[model samples]
Target: MNISNYIDYALLKPSATEHEIIELCHNAKENNFYSVCVNSSYVAVTKQLLVETDVKVCSVIGFPFGAMATKAKVYEAKLALENGADEIDMVINIGFLKSRNYVSVLRDISDVKSAIGDTPLKVTLEISELNKNEIIRACEICLDANANFIKTSTGFSKGGATLTAVKIIKKTIKNNAKIKASGGIRDYETAIKYIDAGADRIGTSSLIKSSTHAHQIRNTKIYRKYIETIQKTTDSAKPNNTIKEKEV
Candidate 1:
């Protein structure tokens, strides 16, 4: 329950090399950032690197874009798990969601969840493209699909997580599912503010830099409070077995 607890410290990049991934995973394991988020292709290597550590291997499915066929997403999820991914962060089909094709969205999430079984699923809602009402509805759809978490953005969007969006998502989910605020969160202050606004997880590429000096104190305080709140909420929501944390 410290600054370490709130960070999912992402390392997502389309151009990341194997050597970079190895180094990144090593550093992530050393620093004890909650988890290391990476592309599915590196799940095997990441698993190998994080072997004995508590740091999990979080792989993205359907990646920065979620327009893939549903079957492809399901296959991708299964493959990632088979390769040692502990969690799957999948982007929702924004096109489908915006069109109000709720059934397709629900099915997409449900299929991936079923493929992964107990492995946690964090469905990216791409908040920047969603209106307030759509954001609320997306949260409801995610919950109804039995998604474990609702994520804010893909970091490829026009904008990323916003305080207002996080608040609305929290209100819609109401602790039934957690929220992950990703994209454009570069500093400790911005990350802490999101946590205070009710984000259970933070996904940012600036993990190392953000953990520096003055802001560290604030980040620690906010993250600890977030974890404490999580413990209490999880205690009442379901059994410990059901509260697995997903990175990415």
Candidate 2:
């Protein structure tokens, strides 16, 4: 399976320097990974690096912690898009979700979605901070808010993506809201398991390949009901070839 299509080629480290960001974009360009998920500051450079390529630039909004004010998240998302971000991965307020104030969480996601317009929004649930019931409830709220994807973990928490958490998210989401299994994934082997377990995308940093557009995905086909905006998961629908690493 050419898993490169499923990978986001993540590099969300706080200590990442501008040089490293440039290198990250270079590496992403050299490989057919679906996108480069980076902090908002690097969106512009990454976008410039990835020009004329299918590899998209995904920016994190609200970031590892979702405690920022709703307006702040909206502004961040807007600015990221202005700087050339193709996707917005925003964190949900864990405290608000724990407080059973579901309305606030819903509005938080919806507000960002509105600000970004057609740029698909991924709601990071921080599955590590929530229990099964809470995860389900958070997924419901994201569904109500019309989020494009439900991501697991920020890799900043105690735990990262787990097959069990992916199962919970898969069971909870309505419509075609895709699932991005992020955090902890660093190899092709582990990433494969997440997809088999139902993840529509994989976020990682330690994986790479020689650049080739053989499996790159395009940004089209909105999967929403009333709103025809934002693209679907990076070619999640493409059939995985039986060709193995040895063959490649």
Q: Report the number of the highest-lDDT candidate.
A: 1
Evaluate model 1: give its TM-score: 0.84
Off by over 4 Å in 2: 208-248
The local distance difference test score of model 2 is 0.86
**Leading candidate by TM-score:** 1
* Residue 59 CA displacement from its true place in model 2, Å: 0.3
Model 1 worst lDDT window (10 residues):
207-216
| lDDT of candidates 1 onward, in order | 0.88, 0.86
lDDT of 1 by residue, 1-248 (tens): 25666677777788899998888887787778889999888899889988899998889999888999999999989999999998899999989998989999899999999889999899998888889999988889899989999999989989999999999999889989999999998877788889899999899887544446646777889999999999999889875565667886
| Span of 10 residues, lowest total lDDT, candidate 2 | 213-222
- TM-scores for all candidates: the values are 0.84, 0.83
Candidate 1: where are CA atoms >4 Å away? 208-248
Per-residue lDDT of model 2, residues 1-248, tens digit only = 77778878888889999888888888877777789999999999899989999999999999889999999999999999999999999999999999999989999999999999888899999988999999999999998898999999898999999999998889777446999998898766677789888899998778643223222311222224214322334356668877777764
Error of 2 at 215 (Å): 18
